[model samples]
Target chain A: MSKNYSDLNLIVRSLLPENQETPISFLPEDHLQTDLFFRRNHFTYPSLTNSSYWLPIVGAVHTPILFSFKDLVQMPSHTVKVVLECAGNKRNLFKPKVFGEQWEKGALSMGRWKGVSLKTLLNVTGLKHDATEVVAEGYDYGNRTDIDHTFSYMRSLPIEKALHPDTIIAYAYNDKPIPFKHGFPLRLIVPQWYAMASVKWIKQIRIINKKFHGPFQSIDYVYYPQKESDAGAYPVTYNRVNSIIQQPLNREVLDTGLHIIKGIAWTGKGTISKVELSVDHGETWIRAVIDRPYNANYEWINWSYEWEISKKGEYTLMAKATDSFNRTQPPEAMWNRKGYGYNAIDTVVIKIE
Target chain B: MSKNYSDLNLIVRSLLPENQETPISFLPEDHLQTDLFFRRNHFTYPSLTNSSYWLPIVGAVHTPILFSFKDLVQMPSHTVKVVLECAGNKRNLFKPKVFGEQWEKGALSMGRWKGVSLKTLLNVTGLKHDATEVVAEGYDYGNRTDIDHTFSYMRSLPIEKALHPDTIIAYAYNDKPIPFKHGFPLRLIVPQWYAMASVKWIKQIRIINKKFHGPFQSIDYVYYPQKESDAGAYPVTYNRVNSIIQQPLNREVLDTGLHIIKGIAWTGKGTISKVELSVDHGETWIRAVIDRPYNANYEWINWSYEWEISKKGEYTLMAKATDSFNRTQPPEAMWNRKGYGYNAIDTVVIKIE
Candidate 1:
C-alpha cells in the first residue's frame, strides 16, 4: 500500500508503450478504462503467448497474401473518430436474466482512431473473387468450450463494411501510438459498430468466398430485433441511438441555486436530432440546448440545459434522445435476449434546498 | 505476458477490499480513486514537519477546536454529493502566461462525501464566538517566508459556507470508504466550490476567532471578476455556469442518414433552466431536449439534438447554456488574470453528406 508512485509507474510503463503517455491525470472518476479491474486482466496473451499475430487477406476485392509486422508498417495511414462500446455494457440493468460482465456505462470511450485502412491492407494482399465475409482472430485464450474455455474473442463483418476506407486496422490513438492493452501494434476500427468487431491483439485476418461463421459472430455480439421472427435473426450491426446521465447519479448533487443539467448522446446509423429532458418523471418535455456540432459519426455528442429552483425540494429527472432519422431513445428498457445494447432512457433523483 | 485471467484477478483481490465481497464482476468503474499522478509524492509524515496541513474554522460559528482525525470522526455523520475542481482546469487555453499544472477537465469529480458537519464538528470541541473566515492549510513543499512558496494545494472559505449542512469532513466516497490517494479517511467537501478547498490528506482542523493567514489562503486560487477592478483581487469561490463538448470534437461522417449530437452541461449554484444550441456556429439558436431534472445542485445534466443532412456540406455547431438567474455561458473565453473559471461557449465543426 505504501509503494512508491514511481515504482507503480514503472510497472505500467513496462506493460504499456512509453510513447502513449496520458499523464495518468486525464483519467476521470467516471473514466475507468485504466482502473486495475480492466488493466489486471489485460495483456496476458501478448506477454505469455508464443504466437505472434498475422494479417492475411483472402477476399473478393483484394489480393490474397499473409502480411507481417514489417508489411503492416509499410501501409499508408488514415485517421478517423470512432467510439468503442463493449458488448457487455449496461449489463447491470439486465439483472437476473443477464449473464455477463456487470459494466456500468463506463465500457465506452471516444478517441481519434489512427491506423491503416483495413480496405487498403486487404488490397495490398490478393483477394479471391466472390468473397463476402471478412474474419478477424485474436490471441485471447478461448476454451473453444464453455466450462473451462479461455475467453474467445473473434468476430467477422461483411466485406462491404470491412472495405470502407474509414474502417482501419488501427495502430494508434489520440495521434500517439497505442498501448498494448488498447490493441497495440494492430487492431481493427469499425466506426459506429460494437467493439467486438474491433478485435484486439489481432493475429490474423481471413477473407472467405463463402459465409464465415463463428460463435462471436453468430450466437454472441448479435442484436436480435425486438420481434423475433421466422425470417431468421439479424446480426447486431450498427449502433443504436443512446445517452447516459453523467450528473446526479449516486454521489453527486446540485447547489440550492440556478444550475444546469448535462450528459452525452450519439448513434451508429444516424445523427442525434433531439434530446428531451423531464423533471417530473418524463411528465413534460423541455428542449435542452445543444452545445457542440455533431462532430463524430460514432462518438457521443455533449449536451445540457438551464434550470432554476428558488426553494428546496426533491425531484426525479430524466433525459431521452432521438436521432436524425426520427429514432428516439426508448422510454422503456428494451428486451435484448442477451441483455446487450441497453440504451434505454436514463433517470436520476435529487433533493435540493 | 501470458498471465491467466484468474491469476490476474488474484492480484486485484490482494490490493483492494477483500471482505466486502462485491463479486469480482460487480465492481463499478468510478468507485476506486487510485490513479498514478495522485499517487506521486504522497505524504507519509509519521510526525509533524515543516510541510504541515491545517484546517481552520472561523466566522459566526461555535464549537471551535483544531482536532485531528482522532477527533474529527468522533462527531456524527452526514453525506452529500460534492464535486471538486482544480482552479487550473483548461489552463492550456491560455498557455505561457500561467505557471501551474496543465490539467484537462479530468481533475474534477463527484463523490459521496461523508463526515461531520464543520458546525457540528466544531460544536463538539468548543467555539470562540465572532469568527468570520475559515482558512485551510496543506502540506505542499514551499518556503515559509515566501507566500508563493506555500504548498501546491490549498483554499479557504467564508465561515457560513464552511458550516453549511451540505458541507462536511468527507471520509468516505461512493459509499464503502476513501483510499489514501483520495484524501484518505478525512478531508473537506465544500459543495459547489472548487476542489482546492477540499484539501487532501487532512491533518488538523483548528477553530479560531481571527482571520487565518497562509500563502494558499490569500494569493493563489484567486480569480478577479471581469466587471470588477483588475487591480483588486478576490479569492475565487462559487463555480460558474459552464458546459463541455464531451464528444464529436472531430465530427464523424456517417453514410447519408439521421444523426444525433450529445454532450453534458452544468452550473455551480442552482438547477439549469435552459440550454440553447446553435447548429450554424452560434448564428442561429434552437432548444435541445434536456435529459434530467434540474434539481440536483452539484451534478451534470445530459442534453442533445438531431439533425438530418440531405445534401453534403460543411457546417459549424455551437452550444450555449443559461442558468436560473439568466446567467449564460459566454460566447468567448474570458481574459482571466490567472486563467481560472473558464465557462466560455463550446463549439465544433462538422461535415455532412
Candidate 2:
C-alpha cells in the first residue's frame, strides 16, 4: 500500500536548511528514518512494545493457532537480503512539482530481513483449502484510531504469497530479533515488494475463503495510474528498475579527480543483474561492477564504477539497474495517478571547476 | 484515498455485547458524542495550532511552499459543508465472519470544513503546470513516528480536487476557527466525499504531475473487482445510497400503533430525492418524509417516516434512498475485492410483540 496526501494543503512553516531540496541517495544519517504509513502522512515509529507477540490464525483455517513469541523464538530462522522499498520510493524523481516526501531514493533500503517462513507456520497449524486469502493485521494502531476509524493496520495476500515457503513470519533481522522500530516480536516478511506487505508487529493471521476488504486493504495502499485507462491502473507491485548516484549531489566539491561513482540498484521482483552508469547525460554507458548478489528475493544490491575525470567541466551521472527479469530502469517512469513503484533510473549532476 | 485493513488479524480483545451494535442512524444529539477517544487504542489528538505546525511543498511543485500557522492563517478562506465519513463507516455490516471495526454505521459525520484552496494559493504563487498531483501531509504525531515511515496523516488528491472551487483551505469550522481537537488553525475540507478527505493538522502540500504512489493511495483507497481482469482496478468514490434506522435497534420493543422511523440518508453526488421504508424485508415500501435538505452539495440529510403498525410479527424495517439524479439504492451492492460503496438497501429489524 502507498500513502498519498489527498486532503491537505501544506505550507512550509520553517524548514532547516537541510530539510530543503538537497538531494542524495540514502536518507541522511541524522535525519529521521521513519516508516511510510499511508493513513498517516508523517513518519511514525512504535513507541511501546508488547512484551509478547505472535501470529494467530483463525477463520477457515484448520484450528485457530496463536504462535507466541516463545514459539517464534524456537522456530528455525533464515536471513534473506531483501530491499524494503516504499511503493513511492522515488517520488522525488518527478520534476517541476510533485506531491509526497521528496523521497529522492532513500525510501528503498536493502536489509537482511530475518524471519521464519509463513508456510512453515501455516503447515504447523494445518492448512485449510477453503482459505482463499490470508488476512494479516499489523500491531500498530491505525492512524486515526483515536478518531473512531475502524481500519486497523492490515492487508491481505493471496494464499499464494502466504504459502510461498520463502515468505517468512520474521522475528529477527540481521541475526537478531528485530528492534522494536522494525517490528520486533514478529513480522510477516514478503520479499520483492514494498515494506507494507511485511506487516510489522503482526498479531493475527486470518485464513478466509472470502476476499479481504477493509480500509488498509482496499483504499490506502492501492495506486491509480496517471492515465485514465484501465491499462495503467494496476495495483503497484514489483519495485521498478531504479539506480541512484550516491556519492555527490551538488555537495561540496572537494578536489574532483578520479571520482568513484557509487550508488545502489534494486528491482521489485528479482535480483539486480546489472547496473550501468551513464555520464554526459546518458550519452555513454559504462558497466558498473555489481556487488555480491543479495538473496534471490526482493532486496537491493550495491554497485560502483570508477570515473577518471582528467579535467571536469560539468558532469551528470546516472545509474540504471536491470533485474533478473530483464526489466531495465526507464528514463521516465510510467505516469501513475498515484506515484508508486517509481524505479526510474536516478540522475545526479555535479559542477566541477 | 483510504486505509485498508484486510490483512490485519485482530484478536477479539474484548467483545461488545452481540446485540449492542451501535445504532446506524441517530439524531444530531446521538452522534456518538465522545469527549475523549477510546483508550483501547492509544492515540492522542494532534496539535492543530500553528505554533506546533509547519507545511512544506516538496515535489513537482514550481517552488516548495512551506507554511507555519502565521502563513496559513494569512491566506484567504472560504466556508463549505463537508461530510467526512471514514471508509469503514458500515464496516460492521460485514457480519457473519467479517473482521473489521464492525462499526454499526455512525462513522460518518457532517461538519463545516474550512480551509484555503490549495490551488488558489498555489495559483497566486504559480504552481508548475507539470504539477498534476497534490500530496496533503499532516502533523499527526502518533506512537509510531520514529520508524522510517511516511507521515502519520497523509492523502493524495488529484490536482483537480485541489483546484476545485468548492475545495477550500480551511482555518475554521462553522464560522469559528478550529480548536486543537478539531484540526486547529486549518484543515482541508473536501466537499462531496467521506471525512477521510478532510485531513486534519495538515502540514505540507507536494505537487507533481507524476502519480502520488504510496501505500495509502495504492493499497488503501483502491477497490478491486471480484474478477481480476488483464487490465487494472477501479477507484472508490462518492457515498452510495446509505441510511440508518435511528432508534430502537435491539434494546426496546416498540409498542403496537404509531411509531416514527427516523433516519438520515446521503450520497457522494446529488441531493436526497426520496427515502422509502420497507416493513417486510422488502416486500412493500412507503415514502418517508425528509425533514429538510442540507443546503450544501450532497451532505447527509435527516428523514423520518410514520408507520402505523396495525399488526406486527418480526418486523424487518428497511430504508432506501434515491438521489437527485434518480440513482436509487440497490438491494445488493456490487461485490468487489474491497467492500466499498456498500449502499445496498439497508435492512433494520424491529419487533413489535
Candidate 3:
C-alpha cells in the first residue's frame, strides 16, 4: 500500500488538507488508538522543522512569557478523557446542505489528553484584567478554496473557558507524547466544547481585549441563518448531545434472531443522561443499557440494547441521546448556514432474511 | 506545481475524483474554453487504454447494436449551446444543510456540444415500445464513501427525454473532440437538464422498462425531505432559474465611480426573459440589459447594469433571473435532503471607498 493510504479504515475527506474521518464502528471501548484517531487539518500539516519549539504568550497580558516544549511537559501534568468532535461532523446527514467538508458521523474521536492546565499558563503569564478572549494560533497556513486569502487556523476561547482548570495545553495523548497528526508539541484541549476549540499545533497564544475577528473566528464556524449578512450569527461552541449506532451497519443483512445493537453517546455541556433506541423509525423507543460508572463528564459513554426479532424484513433503527443539560438530539437538526452541530437522531436501516 | 496540478483558474474540490470548479468569473463571452470548464467526477477518471471504443446499446431494444466511437462521430451531427450545471451547485449557499458536495456557483459551465441526436441513435437501435427509461452507465466505477457497495456512475432518463431531438450523444465540446476529462470517447449531453442527466464516459446504454435504481439514481441525487424514509423523494432534473454575479466579487473594494455590474443567467425549461439587479439588498431593483440574441433556449445569457455609486460605503449587490416559464430565482432556496437545485438570489458584498 502507498504511504498516503491509511490502512486503519479511515475515510479521506480531502487529500490536500488531509482530513480523515475515524471509523467510529471500531471505537466501542477505550479511547481510540492514536493511529486510529481522526485527523482534521484546515491546511496541509504544519511543518515543525524548528530545532526547538517555543509557545509564545503575548497580547493583553501583564507579563507575557514564552514556554519551550520542555517547560510545558515539565510542568505538573494532568490527564482527562475528553471527546473532541469537529463542529461540522455529521454534516452530510443534515437536511438542507451547508457549505463545508461533507463530514460523516466519524469526524470525531476521544482521547486521554495529558498536559498542564491552560489556567496555569494564563496565571504564569499574568493575563491583564481587560483580556476578554485568549487566541491560540497554529503554525498551519494556506489558501482555503472557499475564500480569497491565505488563512492560519486560529480559534479563540472566552476568558472563563480559557481559565477553566480542565482546559489544558495538552502535549500528550493516551499516556504518550502526542503524535504529530494530533498536534505533537502542544495543543489545547477545551474539554466541554467542539474540537474546533482545541486548536492544534500551538505556535502562538494571544490574549485579546475585544472579540477575535479572525476568519476562523468571525467568518467560518459561526452559526447563522440563511441570510445575506451576519445579522444574527454566533460562534459555535459546545458539542450537541448525540448518539451513534455502531452495530448492524446500514443495510446489513442477517437471519432473524437476537442481536445486540451497540452504540456511543456524548454531550459537551454535561454527561449523557439517557440514550434510547427505536427500531420502528422513532414510533416506539427502548432505553439502551448505558455502561456502568457513567459519571464521565468529558468522556463519551457506550450503550447497548438487545433485540429479539422474528420478522423477516427490513427495519429502520434510530438512536437518540439526552444530556444532563436537558438537551436531546432532535429528530431533525435545526438548519444553519454552516452545517454545524448536527445532532439529529442517529439512524440506520437493515434487513433480516 | 505537479502533473496533478491544474494551472487554470479552477478550485479543486477533491483530488482523487478530480472535481474542479471553473473560474466562472472569467467566463463573460462565448462558451467557456474547454480547458477552463468545470469538472464534476463521482469517481476517478476511467482508464481508456482500449484500442477501439464501442458504445453498446442493449436491453429492451429490438435491434441492439454497438456503435464504435468513429461510427457515432461520422453520423449526421448537431450542435447546441447548453448550460450544464451540477445539481448541487450553490449548495453551500443554502439554508439548513444537506448532504453531498457543498459546491459553489462555479460548479457549472456552458459549451457548444456537437454530436448525433439521441433520437437518431435510438431509432437505429430500435428501442422497444415498452422501454421506460434509458440507463446510461459510465465507465467509471468506484466505492462511494456514503454507501456500502461499489457503484458505477449511472443515471436514467425517461424515454421521452431519451428520444428528444435535443438530447445528443455528444462527441465534441466547442467543435473539438471532447477532452479526456470531459469524457473523450462518448458522452450523453442531455440538454435542458442538470449535468447529472448528461452521463459522461459513456460505456453502455441500456433501455430499461422499469425505474432505474442505481445508487446515483435512487440514493445520491434524489431530493427528499429531512424525514427518515424516502417517502417523498424525487429525482432532481432541470437547472433552476439562477444567475451569477461575475463582477465586483464578494468583499471587493472599489472606487466611488460608475461601474458595469455584469452577470450571467440561465434556466432549464426556457430562455431567460428578465434579469434584475438589487444593490440595496433587494429593497429596490433595477432591470439589467440582457445581451442581444437572447433566444438561445439552452444557453445562459449575459446581462449587465451600469451602476453609478458616489457613496463611500459598503454595498450589497444581488442578482435574480427570471425564465420564460415564469420561474424566478427565489431569495431563499427551498431546502432539500441532497442540497440539489439551489436557485437562491445571488449576493455579493463590496466596499466603495
lDDT of 1 by residue, A215-263 (tens): 6777666655443442445677777788776654421233466767777
Which candidate has the highest DockQ of all?
Answer: 3
Q: What DockQ results do all the predictions give, each relative to the true complex?
A: 0.02, 0.01, 0.03
- Ranked candidates (DockQ, high to low): 3, 1, 2
Query: TM-scores for all candidates?
Result: 0.50, 0.45, 0.54
- As a TM-score, model 2 comes out at 0.45
lDDT of 2 by residue, A273-318 (tens): 8898887889999899977652445655667887777564557777
**Tens-digit lDDT track of model 3 for A151-242:** 88999999999999999999889888889888988999998898988999999999999978888888788888664566778889988899
Model 2, position B244, has a per-residue lDDT of 69
Give the per-residue Cα lDDT of candidate 2 at A334: 66
lDDT of 1: 0.60
Give lDDT: candidate 3, residue B162.
86
Show the colliding residue pairs in model 3.
Answer: A96-B96, A96-B97, A96-B98, A97-B97, A97-B98, A98-B97
lDDT of 2 by residue, B277-340 (tens): 8888898888998876438374677788778886745577788998888999888766544445
Q: Best candidate, lDDT-wise?
A: 3
DockQ of candidate model 2: 0.01
Off by over 4 Å in 2: A1-50, A143-148, A227-232, A250-256, A293-297, B1-353
lDDT of 3 by residue, B1-353 (tens): 22112322455444445666765754547755676677788877888889898999999999999999888878999888888999988876766654445577889888888999988988998978799999999999987544557888999999998888989999998878899889887889998899998999898999999888988888878888664577788888878899999886665556677999998999999789899999998999999999956458888888999999888776889999998889999988978866788898999877675
